[model samples]
Target: MNLEEYIKENTATFDAFLQDFLSINLTNHSAKLLEAMNYSLLNGGKRIRPLLVMAFAQNLDIKKEYYMNVALAVEFVHTYSLIHDDIMDDDDFRRGQLATHKKFDIPTAMLAGNSLLTWAFQILSDESTHPNTEVRNYLTGFLSSSSGHTGLAYGQSLDLEYQFGNKNADYKKILKMHDLKTARLFKFCTRAPFVLCNPKILLNNKKTEHLDIFGTNFGLIFQATDDLLDYRDLDKSVDLGNIMSYKNNDEVVNYCKKLAKEALASLKNLEIDSQVLTELIQFIIIRKS
Candidate 1:
């Protein structure tokens, strides 16, 4: 089975779901900043995070449209991070389009990012969104861990502080930065669906442990890919240039591939479809900037 072809088949579903969640609902006067938020959030790109949410859910036999909401919530969180990253870096373009701040103004873009970030929590906290309150709560808790002190925002803070001659920085510090900055949330993505699949909730404790392990490895692979992409774009001057301290782009990709193998191996006892999971691994290693 062609993974690309399978992705194509699922593209429409992802797109439709994205549109509904990101639809420009707030009036312009109510929050003109929302326009810029919507602009960046709705910008054309591969919806990989959301796809991961649904794909993992499907792999576990938890088939339901409710996964759509969870997936979109993940996307919203990711987009909010990107918007803030652009503003903090004073970036001009994102995915070949004007960054949120550039499209509107700095304050507007910042507010927009804030709005999206909070919206993610709102969606996740809504018990009605998913039948399994355990799943919803598990995801929300992990997201909370990933979004704040334990995750991206916390990681970003340390990264910025390191840049301004915070002399105590070291490889471990950078590694922690990568974990919280890029990897932690991905760990949340890969493992959260398992929480949703606890039919009798008998596997709750064991599955939570298993999922945590899976998420950590998955997070490493994902962060390594980001490093690889930046290393490749060295000529183009892209990448955050911190946390992922690789020797070069080739090393970054190889590291990511190796880490992905370890992560995939952790699932060997499971009965997940090999072909689909293999394709995911390929995407992790060979993705372009």
Candidate 2:
């Protein structure tokens, strides 16, 4: 299948898998929290992180049901970030629908986000996620560190700092924030599969290092393009993160192209097929929503 078709088919399959995996019952006392969590998780998204997980796994020739645990874990963390981010950014809409905080109460949204974040580790800790206990432990620790205080959370802290005018939006600080807030998770997406499968060639520090580089640059490209789109569809109240605030529209676009080139170069160094990943770069640059 072509890249677009491949994405669509895989996305459909993943969504179905995610729905069944959640399998929440509404009769419980915490039903509202469950509903809010489900709403945020199943809400419209590009599913780019999970797609990366699946694509890398497939390219490694290690496709298996356990890989879905990795994919879902990544997405759960991502979704949790978005829900909490919306509340912090005071965004009323998410994916063209009401934000979780708006649809549910702020406390409910907060709990939902917390649950999703914790749920990611819970999923990874399950023996079903990996037969090897060491592998499961590694996955859990990797995910936690990536999304924890030194990673995505740290990035968001930087973003909020800049947003409230507490810090100047210099190019260096902006880039650092982008790396933390956005690219760190992408790093997880790219590196997790190799670590998951424990493939010899990919498992080496040097090779997985390149994958981490690719994921970071790829995520920067995604974030840069998103900034461009935000400029196109500028909302007066919402901050466009730091990129737009630091660089002009044309400069941001050029930086995106540069990041794509760097990311593709990293992919070229890897043993996997990169056709879909290359197309994904183009897709990110051209996507409207």
Candidate 3:
């Protein structure tokens, strides 16, 4: 199957998994909270993060069922970040729907986000994710580090500081913020599949490091693509003027293409077939939303 078809198929499967996994056992007091969590979690998006997990799993010839929980955990973490992000950004809309904080109350939205974040670790720690205690421990640690203060949280703080506090933020600072806030999760998505593979493969530091490089470049491309789209959509709040002044849209597009190529190149030395990954990189650059 082609990349679009592959993504569509996997996205549907992941959506089904999320629906079943997120099914709320309602209590009278918590029904609204559950609704708020489900409202944002079930909301539509590209599902790129989970797709990356699945795609890399496929690259390693791992069974889809084996990685479903892993993929779900990634999605939950992503969703939780979005929930909190909306509140911090005070964005009224998410995926063209009311932001969780707006749809519910701020307290409810915060709780929902907190629940999702905590549940992501729960999923990762469960035997369903991986029977190996070592693997589970590693996954838990990796997710925590990537999503915690050193990773996404740090990046978000930098983003806020850059936008609101530092009028003189340079391209390097912005790129570093994007790396932490966005790329770290993408790094996890790409690298986690290797961790889920056989223990022998997991021990191969060189191979894992190669995958990390691939993920890092891919994450950069994803963010740059977003910046390009925001510019196209005339979202002036992004404060890309300094960056854009140095590099126009065409230049940014070329940079993303370069990063995509480098990402694919990182996989070339490995034995795995990376055609799907190549297509995914292309799709990231070309996708409109």
| Order of models, best lDDT first | 2, 3, 1
Candidate 1 vs candidate 2: the TM-score winner is: 2
Cα lDDT tens digits, model 1, 201-274, are 33556555555555676666676676656655665443344544435566666666777676666666454655
TM-score of each: 0.86, 0.93, 0.93
Stretches of candidate 3 exceeding 4 Å from the true structure: 24-30, 235-246
Which residue pairs show collisions in model 1? Answer: none
RMSD of 2: 2.2
Q: State the lDDT at 178 in candidate 2.
A: 84
Writing each residue's lDDT as its tens digit, candidate 3 over 32-62 gives 8888878887889688999989988987756
The per-residue C-alpha lDDT of model 1 at residue 176 equals: 78
lDDT of each: 0.71, 0.85, 0.82
Off by over 4 Å in 1: 24-31, 132-134, 162-168, 199-206, 235-246
